[model samples]
Target: MRRLADASAPERRKWYARGAFFHAEDLHYLKFLIGEGARVLELGCGTGELLAALRPRYGVGVDFSAGMIGEAHKAHPHLTFLVGDIEDEAFIRQLPGPFDVILVVDTLGAVDDCQGMFENLHALCARETRLIVGYFSHLWYPALKAAETLGLKMPQPAQNILSPADVGSLVALADFEAVKSERRLLLPARVFGLGRLFNRFIAPLPLVSSLCLRHYTVCRSLRHRSADVRSASIVVPARNERGNIEPAVQRIPRFVEDLEIVFVEGHSQDGTWAEIERVRAVYPHYDIKAVKQPGKGKSDAVFAGFEVARGDVLIILDADLTVPPEQMPKFWEAIRSGKGEFVNGSRLVYPLEVQAMRFLNLIANKIFSILFTWLLSQRFTDTLCGSKALRRSDYARLKAARGYFGEFDPFGDFELIFGASKLGLKAVEIPIRYASRTYGQTQISRFRHGVMLLRMVVFAFLRIKAM
Candidate 1:
């Protein structure tokens, strides 16, 4: 650490410029992980370049090297910079915290005690705060060493060379849960047109992404402060599922203080709306409400129900009842216990019941799952699952960002998934047993819908990946 302080600004600038392409990739990825106007604190923020680019409402940068801090303060006057060691608990205790985002980019490998750093960061985080750690992949150590020896890269002291799993374990020991992890920057150096193609398309693929130059992990504190005790509102968007309405109302379990059921009936040819009213009448003890959707798609109905929902947690349950309402407790428990911020149902993990899903639809689901997992940089086994859960506040944030994807999603799944990813919410997939519907014909047109899904995939690429 003392050696870093001894280095001059010009020498550091030359060294950093040698890996300009790599730094650019890191900046782009970090911007995506953090939202606008967030209060951000960056550890080891050399020159404060990345912090300044984020345009944070409140930004504080800390580095042990006095030279680096001086350069950062000079370069980024808008942000606060101080020379302090993160490993020093006394110094960390003095810093104002509870930041929205805490960044430790490219500094974990240089730390003497990774767990101690995380523990100190824990004190600076709230329940909603996210800690993003970026480190070089140990697999690239030999190549990096060779580049340094040839003067193509900056020379550095011996690094700890920690793997993603090692960091994850350390995070857990420090009372933080790992939310998401990804590998990036497959083409570290610029190569004209080829670099964009490889990094944007080829490098994100499963087998190829493992060989990327850098790895990032996003984590959150394990303490359940805001969601310790909450109520729930289950929103069921029904099109032509009159037969299952009563059973859904009866089977939905209660795991919170109060549970309200909101059924948004789409324009169904059958008496689905009447059935919803009848169920409310039959179960007068249950807090149930029904509304007719003025629009066409399930997405419209979902938004309508959410508008009237009055609970701490909001949930989406399909009217077809393929995913049993009995599983609602698991979703509630997950968010309430702080296991995940966005809970998505995954039907692919378990064996499906007979005729649960048609062969063609199943195949399409599997294909889209893989494509979406790659696009979102998050593992999603069942992208079309209807049973999803999240906090009401989180849903409000997603609603505000809906214009990014526009009103294109008819199934209502991708909109939430994309929004959650954009907000950097921790998405957790809960495995559920899928069953065949007992009543009403299937509404999906396999061929037409499949084509629309393909178009959505392309849209995702343009919006999410191409950027």
Candidate 2:
């Protein structure tokens, strides 16, 4: 602490101006983590390069050195600045309230007390907070030493050499989950064509990108949420098929532990709501609620039902019964096994009931599956057969990040798929038998819905693949 106090302000300023190793680091980080209009707090924002790159409308930069804070203020005049130790609870207390994205670039490695820093940062985040942390990898310590010796990168102090697991442990101790952790380089694309090649070939592949230059960690804030394992939301959006309600509920496999049924009666000319109420009366033992959709379509109806749902796991079950209730246990098993954050039902793999899908539908499903697999770098065997499962915690993250895709999706498939892709969640598909809908006429307008699907595909290309 004495040596740090005696360190000349001009020395720190010179070091910052030189911009060693991490000059362009924030550009990628801002593109990947901190999107526009987000409220962001940056710890140890020396020279404020990342702060300026993110262009946060509500940005706050913190640093311990008065010189660093001055330089940050000069470099990024728009952002608010507070010169204080990140570990100081009283200092964090004096600042403003919670932020959406809190960054700690190159802060943890230098902190004298890493545990204190983690505890304090946990206090600054809400349940939906995202923290992007990166530091030079200790695995590359030899290369760094070699580079410094060769005078490529400057070296002076004995910086703390830590592993990715060390940082992740600290994050977990802070009560946040490490959603994504990766290693990226300071190397330029032009100079290293092979590096760029890896980005195209191997990096986009699921599960391989985690080990690439410096250690990068993306953490989600913690909430003491209880999984009302029994309070299940079964959403069945039905249309002209008025006869399916009672059978759907009765046939819906009792896979979940605690269950409640919410029937989203969407624009059905048939007495779907009346039938739902009839079913509720018949099965007084079941927790059943019927809501006639004020909206027009399945996507809108699903969103509406979700708004009124009070459950831990929100499930989408098509009224057509293409996916039987008995198969839901497979989804539960996939989720419980921690195979994926989102468990999508794949009808293409298993044998479907004869006449399950028309020839064109099967072809379209296969084509879109290939395209999305290529685009999001995640495999999906079927995209249109509307059955998806995820936790409410994940749904909250999607809601918070809705601006990323806006309200353009009408099918509801893009919402979860795109959200999970961007959030770096492991999306797994479970094979299920597709039973042809027994009760209702199909509501999907082939041409109109196909066009919407095409629009979503293009939108997803830009949002997930191109970006």
| lDDT tens per residue, model 1, 1-467 | 56755485547777777778878878887887787799999998877888898999999999888888888877889889989888999888888888999999889878999998898886788878889989988999999999989998877778889888888999999988887787778889888867767887777667888898888898888763347546899999999999989999888887766989999999888999888888888899999989998888888999899999998888999999999899999998888877788899999989999999988888989999999987887789999998999899889988988888877777888899999888778888999999999999877777987788788899888777665
Highest-scoring model, lDDT: 1
Clashing residue pairs in candidate 1 are none
**What's the TM-score of every candidate structure?**
0.91, 0.67
The alpha-carbon lDDT assigned to residue 365 of candidate 2 equals: 91
What is the per-residue lDDT of model 2 for residues 1-467, given as tens digits with 9 covering 90 to 100? 42452354445545544543345543654466566788889887765767777888799998777776776777678789888878888898777858878888777767888766777776676645677787876656777777768755545456777788988888788776676665555342334456444543454344554544556777765542123244467777777666877777778777766777788888777887778878899999888878888877787888787877777777888887778876766666555555556778889987777788888988889999998887765678897768887777778877777778766767788787888767656577888888886776677777788888888888775565433
Per-model lDDT: 0.86, 0.72
Candidate 2 local lDDT, residue 285: 89
With candidate 1 superimposed using the best TM-score fit, by how many Å does residue 280's alpha carbon deviate from the native? 3.7
CA error at residue 47 for candidate 1, angstroms: 1.4
Q: What is every candidate's alpha-carbon RMSD to the true fold?
A: 2.5, 6.1
Clashes of each: 0, 5
